[model samples]
Target: MAASTQRRGRRIMMAPEELDTFLREARTCRVATVSADGTPHVGALWFVWDGTSLWLYSITRSKRWAQLRRDPRISVVVDDGEDYGELRGVELSGTVEFVGEAPRTGEPCPELDVPERLFPAKNFGLDDMPHDGRHAWMRLTPTAIASWDFRKLGGL
Candidate 1:
């Protein structure tokens, strides 16, 4: 006898609400970008999902920034799974647009502080943290998205 596949498809598919909830609670995403020469770079990033787009805060002098400036196309993966049945993830492919200049040498931008506000709260359950460096913020507007939940594969 064959196990049912109804739950399989449903589980793998995240409804709009489920997807938003998962993204809201996720801590990290693997951000992928390409260099001018076509080499690929992937880095784990702390992000904030504001319903419509993902906001990323990064050091202006980092390699990821350099590569992104050269080519803005990017892909991001947010997933977790210690076991097969628990696996769930989302992939967002898009282009990044710089939202604003890096903050002054030792100050924070009140408007672009989502990462500063969210990182601590989500990762450590804290509401605030000292601002770090001259950081720039970028917004990723996803062109396509794909997601899955292995729990759907249950009922076997």
Candidate 2:
């Protein structure tokens, strides 16, 4: 699908590359899902932006997982900055698919270690994460996305 864009003064819209960078640099994203009864569930998750899609490692037993099993649609938001002038973010909506096996609680598993490998290197400058197990990967291929950078408004 084509990238979504909204006009804001004279600044150019955030291109696809810019959106990838934004998702990569941000440490955490808020994932939103809906329950069978239509109640909204939102939670913070550590994610990896692998150029084409968002990969999330989650505990299989979590409520979010249960909700996603019933409904695969999800919305994710990743953003940063303390003040309004510095605010910037990306919002993505898509359907997610479960990938690979879920590491059972107290079991040893290596496939679900993207966080162990990528999170530390990208966020903490470390070689590896010091933990493991009880998690699974969820892949979201965004169908629609929107992003904004307050810095783009400086010229106005």
Candidate 3:
């Protein structure tokens, strides 16, 4: 992921360590994709952050998947907190690259090892990943990342 050179809200930005922790713990993210006709679609998905990249396991037949196949550009937001002052989130935007196979079925791809381990452990508390033939991997190493922790404002 490319570093954010955000100039407007430096005070509210999460430090690198804080961002990593947040992404690791967060459960669901909203993925935004554009169709060939320029229609925008957003859907919630389970993901894993491997310190450097975000991995999305998506159903190959889904709308989001179809749209991404047409156009790889995507934006993802992982956020938490109910109140204004408590809000914090990360926005990652870039193109996604399909990893492994379409509708992965436990292929021996060394590239998937880390995320395969991390995803189940974080989301399902499992020692190993269970592969459903419907889902496959997409990796987004963001071109730009912007994060904010409103909690850092100290109730202002």
Candidate 4:
């Protein structure tokens, strides 16, 4: 059997349940922003989808935080590891807002000892790594949403 590579430009969808599932299953998303010189910047961030909205936290001193402070416009990507027909992901473009500091629930994890942050931290390493004193929280509001899943059911 020949494999077909189905393609579409904007497969954006906004169903409450589908969004929730995507958030639950995916761990990391690539965040894109613009620098002062109009160049594009991208970084991988751990994020959590809280039902109606997506919540992400960043430290105060990072360059991404500094750039985002000036420009709130951002693009986010969430996906899996599969190739070709088995690919799945969600791309989001939205307005960003800088909130207060990222808090720690209790004692920090041992991974916090590693300054490089090479280990997993989140429920499935799909979210941010909480450290001793990272910057703060940056929230993205979805002005537009696009999702793709080669699965047959398509989140039904």
lDDT of 2 by residue, 1-156 (tens): 344455452253466688778887887999999999999999999888767778887888899999998999999999887777677788888899887666534234464465456766886788865435677778888887877777676743
Ranking by TM-score: 3, 1, 2, 4
Pairs in clash, predicted candidate 2 = none
Tens digits of per-residue lDDT for model 3, 1-156: 476576778999988999999999998999999988888999999999999999999999999999999899999999999999999999999999999988999989999999999999988999999999999999999988899999999996
TM-scores, all models, native as reference = 0.80, 0.80, 0.97, 0.69
Better of 2 and 4 by TM-score: 2
Candidate 2, residue 130: how far the Cα is off, in Å: 6.3
State each model's CA lDDT, in order.
0.77, 0.77, 0.94, 0.62
Pairs with backbone N, CA or C atoms under 3 Å apart (clashes), candidate 4: 12-146, 27-126, 46-127, 46-128, 58-136, 59-134, 59-135, 60-135
**Model 4 ranges off by over 4 Å:** 1-15, 102-131, 153-156
Task: Give RMSD to native, each candidate.
Answer: 6.4, 3.5, 0.9, 9.3
Full-model lDDT, candidate 1: 0.77
lDDT of 4: 0.62
Residue 28 deviation, candidate 2, in Å? 0.6
TM-score of 1: 0.80
Which regions of candidate 2 fall more than 4 Å away from where they truly are?
Answer: 1-12, 104-117, 123-131
